[model samples]
Target: MQVSVKHSLPGRLRLLYDKNEYTSKQALLAQTLITVQEGILDTNCNTNIGSFLIYYDTHIVKENDVLNLFHALTGKYLEDPELLKNVDQIPETESIESVLIETLAIHYLKKWFLPLPVRTLLLWKSLLERCFHVLSKFAESKRLFSTELLDATAITVATLTGNKNTASQINLLLNIGEEIEEITKRNSYGNLAQSLLSADEPVQVVEGMDEKTVPASALKKDDVVVIRQSGLIPADGQILDGEGMVNQSSITGESIPIAKKAGDSVFAGTVLEEGEIYIKVVQTGKETKVQKIIDMIDNSQSLKAAAQQRSELIAEKVVPFNFLVTAATWFFTRNIVKTMATLMVDYSCAMKLSAPIAVLSAMKESATKGITVKGGKYLEEAALSKIVVLDKTGTLTYANPVLEKIYAMEGFTEDEVLTIAACLEEHYPHPLGRAVVRAASEKNLVHPENHTKVEYIVAHGIASTLNGKKVRIGSAHFIFEDEKIPCPESLAEIKKQSSLEGYSLLYLSHDGILVGVIAIGDPARPGTSEVIRELKNLGLEECIMITGDTEGAASKIAAECGIKKWISQALPEDKVKFIEDEKAKGHKVIMMGDGINDAPALSAATVGVAVEGCCSIAGETADIQLQKSGLDNLVTVRRLGMGLLEKINENNLTIVGVNSALMLLGIFGVISPQMAAILHNGTTVAISIRSMQPILK
Candidate 1:
């Protein structure tokens, strides 16, 4: 690669380079590297033009120095960390095992291949590195005691006492332990990153009544694509035709596949597990929903649980204690070897390494089981939450409603009432509205907009004027109570029977009088009852259902799902108040919801779980998103939460117990400094490796 200056200024220079000399990726890398240098303030690179513009401080960097910098990238300099320092998000290509093996190879090669005098001198470099780290840490915090300080003291003492072999082994063990713990924690991210979309894959699109294949980059907004069985969805798009079961593990972290049909949404990176679907592309590439999931994983460090932070704080605080033990042992026994043993077994190192590895590893495992935990704290919260509150519409009744019965009053006909309802409802997105409209459409009832302006009362009903009289349609609370429409005595029995059957009733009225009743069958998701029972088996304290359905319908569904407690005719605010009330009573609540109305309550609960969707509704943006179509993933999340919390506690206890035993054995003079160091680091590596295992069966 070659670089040259095409134009120059005191503080700004326009540099030119051969386009053939470097790839576009290398251009961006060069730009990133140069921007972080002391004098270079900013840089803009146009790989297409084979040139870059640099803005630098002339007093700090000269034109000659800038040209010399570019010349240094001629060969074997691209992977150098020194060149990329302070530049963020650069991909790491080096493997942890390779680093460990290389370090080990270097350590042993000097001892076996080199003569004693030369090998002994090489050991000082390792001692100096340890001593520098110890001093630098103290310089930053003004603290005399730390894990690094302990290691440095022990290593320095061993070397000064003519124990070069012991000094080298101690540093090698510490280096190996650090590498192992780092890889253990990082393995989760590596697995998660594997699910990122394969951007270069081709997709099939509809063109002029025929299907044709095109690159994913060729797809754009509103373009229709056909996905077959076992095909990967290339973009975030809505289904326009056909149906299939989409495996959303890549996006929602759940392995369960969801059935999709026309008018349903599908996301990029999700596989069409079964059947097929024709999708109208909404967004593709980096803008897809799966990309967002990848972004979330990339930033999960910021979402560390309270438990993880506390363990880390305790780890730091315990450092001074280790030093105190070492100082006390040396003063009383007057034995250098005994002093080195206590210093070798560090409590802080084990706790600090294992806690985050446990939390992150558990999170990674949960994603594979189809639950995306937004924060480690939420998993901790899930482990402790006693109550589970579920939203009704999408939470309990998983799909759109179907119009089951139309009861017309004496003055009107059934078709007339259905037409009026459908005309008004076709404009809204609610499930019941869709049911009414769909029923009307199937019967070939063309009910266009004949009413005046429609007024929507959220969680209540719709109101409008039909030829000058007031027409109302919604829940029993909306029409009969809020709108002051009187219920006919003759229809009381029918209303009671409808509710008992678990069918949501939509009441219609005109001019303050009852006109008709529409019973909508919003069935419970398959195996919902079994899921609730299983949750109870998992030690859930209580399960509560909240909905805007009539009392009879709410009661029947609750009973069928084995949910003992329920709140009917609930508005959005009522949901929020219920969660707050539960919190006030000292109970931790897990709120599972699906709609936009459920946002507040989801946030109010101890841990918000979004189900059957990617975000809030999990894809709807909840703390935990169940990407699958049912509530069974709830069982998975609960198991994972409890498992993670338990594992973390178990690891902490094991670390303390093992390290304490090591310190005792050392104080008794049963082990050398090398043996003490080996046992201590071995415990840390073992605990970290165990923490990285799946917490769930």
Candidate 2:
């Protein structure tokens, strides 16, 4: 238990243990050390060198406290073997393979070396236990031909007939198959969980203006951390000083790199794709937004699709019929052997196992391609979606909009209009707001807090007061129609000029009079038309674009994107109503958007997809989050879902056809009970493996 401190800091420590002393006990010691207090954030153990590192909150517990606890625990463990009882064994997941190998070898040896009476007794005992286990499941819910029932029945019949060898063989095969199934399921789920919880490499933290490398767990709120190009942001915080193009696909599922400068907010798990930034941490640990989203996804099983639930119910319901058929075979044929064979080939094994395997595998495959589908049900909806409703600004086009021009009315200078507009818009994160703020920054225009707190009206505009004068900025519909603001006849020509440019216009007003018009140019994303065509070819019957932009701008973008149906100046409620109307007409709706205004429609659709670089709210509201920036990945999701359905259907056919053939052969005396047991179990295992294969390939 001798240890030496390899490194030490205020909130962190790394220790190297005497390799010869600890040997295989490094993991046990590491686990025991963390239980010393709740201040320990994380611990890592390298058993090979008998070294461990601990990260803790110095504000809650000091370094001496942890070191003292570790020493005391080491002393106690060395003095008493009783204290090490529970920690002596390796974890089950770490040793399952070895355990299976050893068990198989021992079973083989006993089968050959043991006497017939002893073997028969052992086999009978195991068979009885298995049958009891199956019967116990009735307390929960009855499933007549469950794999447990099939296995128990097969082994019981063989043991009663004094065919001890056949009974042992059946039990061994079933046990091995079950182990393999458990391992496969765990591996698939583990792959995804690991991906989400994967730790980043040590990050550089600026402590009192001195930079040093430390584990991400060492980060605390308000700590200034320096992130370089391609470095993952260690925690959620605001940019204090520096600029970068941040790729937040990991957190928000957006693939486009956002231009982040001083005063802008960033999230943990996002990467600085280019440049560097020093962020003042606002939230760390499990309090970060990404962690919360991951927690939600982890617990989203309740959202399972109707089809998956039906498949499970059907699997269970067919079990009773399997038992009935076996009884009929025994009654009519008057052969115990045939009855045993019939029991061996029930549909429940493949039916129950293959469907979930196909679904989980498809989910894993989608994750690899940068799409996160919360559950299998959403995949079902994605495959069946007929009508796709798209939001124009961030979903169909890039969110990075440029301020093209600004026209000021009489009594207001262009700079004055932009300064006030920027001050108001900076409080919101919409594309238009960002465009105005960026323009002001580029022009070196400083707009201080010359206004009261801004009020954001979703799908409308920003309302605030500047120098006791009411000011508003938003779409033409919001300012002129909703707010009842009047556009002066003198500015008619200016409005006409802005409209002809095919750019989106935001109206700015002062005291109920339109004083300025800001033109924002956000071009349709490249390949939009091609993606729309591909979606149609893939069976999307209707494609529509809904936007709050002017009719001219919406029409121009829709035409460019090959969309024939376009709704202009539509409010958030209008988009929701559109989806509801489509659903009422028997069409399954898929909504794709990346803005706060799109949240309602996204939640109302059959399948909601949030594109990469979307706002946090949009990403959270959507069912499927696409990590890629473009629409190309949308097709991948559609195909993946369809592929899963196809694979499940194929597996069903295979299970039914193979089991039916085996039953016929057994009843006709063409195959023995032993052969039936082997073939049926082997087929189930093979199909289960096939179900886990990549759907796209």
Can you give the TM-score per candidate against the true fold? Answer: 0.64, 0.67
Query: Scored by Cα lDDT, where does model 2 land?
Result: 0.76
Give the per-residue lDDT digits (tens) of candidate 1, residues 147-188: 988888898888888777778888888888877777766665
Query: lDDT of model 2 at residue 433?
Result: 74
Residue 472 miss distance in model 1 (angstroms): 25
Segments of candidate 2 deviating more than 4 angstroms: 1-100, 113-118, 143-145, 195-205, 212-220, 225-279, 284-301, 401-495, 499-520
**Top model number, TM-score:** 2
lDDT of each: 0.76, 0.76
